[model samples]
Target chain A: MKEHKKLPSAVIKRMPRYYRYLTTLQQMGISRISSRDLGNRMGVTASQVRHDFFSFGASGLQGYGYDVDLLRQEIRDIFGLDDLFSVIIIGAGNLGHALAKYSGFEKNGYKIAAIFDVKPEIIGERINDIEIIHLDKLQEYVQDNHVDIAALTVPEIRVLEVAKLVTDNGIKALWNFSPIELLASDDIVVENIQMIDSLMVLGYNLRTAEAKLNPN
Target chain B: MKEHKKLPSAVIKRMPRYYRYLTTLQQMGISRISSRDLGNRMGVTASQVRHDFFSFGASGLQGYGYDVDLLRQEIRDIFGLDDLFSVIIIGAGNLGHALAKYSGFEKNGYKIAAIFDVKPEIIGERINDIEIIHLDKLQEYVQDNHVDIAALTVPEIRVLEVAKLVTDNGIKALWNFSPIELLASDDIVVENIQMIDSLMVLGYNLRTAEAKLNPN
Candidate 1:
């Protein structure tokens, strides 16, 4: 892979969306797609699509458009999706169970290696054949396995301590679902799934759309 | 509330983050905050914070900075959170159950009015005191009640059909958790919670951070 300069955060955020659209096209057996068509599907202008692709060094043929498979592969490489990532869930609550039972992540090379919780009743149970271990075993498990990501589904009160334990054990990335914001070291990557925030945004948009129609 | 111009999409997206941070500060009894301090907490520049607030006509005092409660209330009003929104879950699976059990949405005024499922076994069950109704009853339920949002947690195969049912019943907003993107009408709002996309971004960031450290 070429050593490309770091793309802007906006472009980085859109890469996964592009990858998803391209995957859909690939699955449909469409080998090529015009920028205009792809952009329409993605709710963006053709020039915006072209600019995003250009940032990543992908150029379409003048008349024939871009190769679906090639563009998907390039995005896959950029996201390092070709490699398998071992993920451990830090809480065995409903959200944790949902993540463990979700088959999408495993299909995309993100394997749920283990799940840990402080509750004794749920510990030792299995979700998708992966046993839920006690929180006490987290450090030992991280040391024994090559874990790439720690998905923090713990409660807000316990999330900070759990994050510290994970980072202390050399985990470099955190996919936090906890309501609180985590302050992690610069080297560690934290991706917070603020579901409430998303809901609030949807609410705002719905209100905006309604106001436009009523205008009262 | 005074009428304001439609904020930029980028600013609209960041509103929830600002709300979250301000909520935290309010809980901490921090009545006033400088743009620099708020910006640091949100991982943005002070000017960026100022710009977003300015877009919404929220101007901070030159010497005293912003009032935490006032800014949060402004954002809440902008998001229309003062009014309770009736929400229904479209699937009774693990993801749906998680959404139904989540107390955050209700705390923020998005009530899970009911949950619907096609399956016979799980249809009548309760999650967080909200009864799961049969999917066949969805149309009747929507007609009887004013539901603002339908949280789609059904499988990808069933999502489109369920979405069609929800929209056909006049629900204007969809909080979609299914992997597939739902194409809604121009006036309807669709917020997709693509967990896989988020995981991929985390993976990419992890890879980039590791590459910076090890350059191989």
Candidate 2:
């Protein structure tokens, strides 16, 4: 990144949104997109989009707007998507299996290096051609293979224990699917996603909208 | 609630975290917790926790702090979690099947009404006892059954088409897993989970943290 200042977490979070939308535009063969049009599609104001772009030193011509391909490339680079990361899924349950088969991560610079599970039945199994190895081999594999991230889809009770194993083995980040909230050191980053929390947000919003529609 | 003003989106987003933590505390048999302790567990400041509670008209005692059960109940009520939302998965893909089998939703207000897909092969299949029905039956099922949310795990190309079908059928909220963003009307809420975006965030953070640890 040319910009010396560290971007805020919120801004960093929105970078992938821009990357996704811009990639779509690029695929559709749209050569250019104005801040206004991009913001409209992204559900943000034009000035907000311009300001966000400025944070990453992405500039647009006064009348012409941003070049679609260049802008997408810039955002992708900003996200460190240019670098490939070897990822390991820590659990071989349904969620883990689904994530293992998800092709989106490979498309966006994440390569599934291995999958670890305690279950002997699934340990040697393969999901979408990615082998599920025993958890005993996790630390050794991570150390030897230089795994970048551990995506934990283990049950809530096993989160802390499994997290310790991954973090101890030099995993710099965690995409946690378990409901348990993890405490990370300054060098380690944890993105704890409680899927139910998201569902609750949806439920709450749905209720409010329902109320507005029929206030009985 | 009692506060006539609608809660801000940021506050609404935090409600689930609060609910989750409090529920954990409640399960641990911890009946009372001060804002400071709660904040410590939640990675926020005591004052910030207090402020968030106040946003929903939840007040902590001067010294005794908040009642864990009471606080959890209040947040649950705020999230409108007392009621159940009938949910349907739009695609019968791996992710969709995983979500269908995920028991967390039923434990927290979201009940899987059914799973829908265009594929004829999987139409009669079942995931966690929920039937996978034809996508053509979605509109009629939703209309007659009153589905509160549609969890879209469809392919990128089919997202817009499937989203329109659900939204038009009065599905109030969408938990979209597809990479493509959905445009929702004012009355409908869309929680777009770009899983790749989250993975990118983890990658970016990892790179930055790695740089800090071993600077070149």
Best by lDDT: 1
lDDT (Cα, tens digit) per residue for candidate 1, span A29-106: 999999999989888999999999999999999999999999998887777777888899998888898899887887
Error of 1 at B203 (Å): 0.6
For model 2, the superposed segments whose C-alpha errors exceed 4 Å read A1-4, B1-4
**Model 2: per-residue lDDT, tens digit, A32-133?**
999999999888999989999888888889999999999888877776676778899998887897888787888888899889999887778888899989
Top candidate by TM-score: 1
- Cα error, residue A176 of model 2, in Å, equals 1.0
Docking tier of model 1: it is medium
Clash pairs, model 2 backbone: none
Which 10-residue span in candidate 1 chain A carries the lowest summed lDDT? A1-10
- The DockQ leader among the candidates is 1
- Assess the local accuracy of residue A40 in candidate 1 as a C-alpha lDDT between 0 and 100: 91
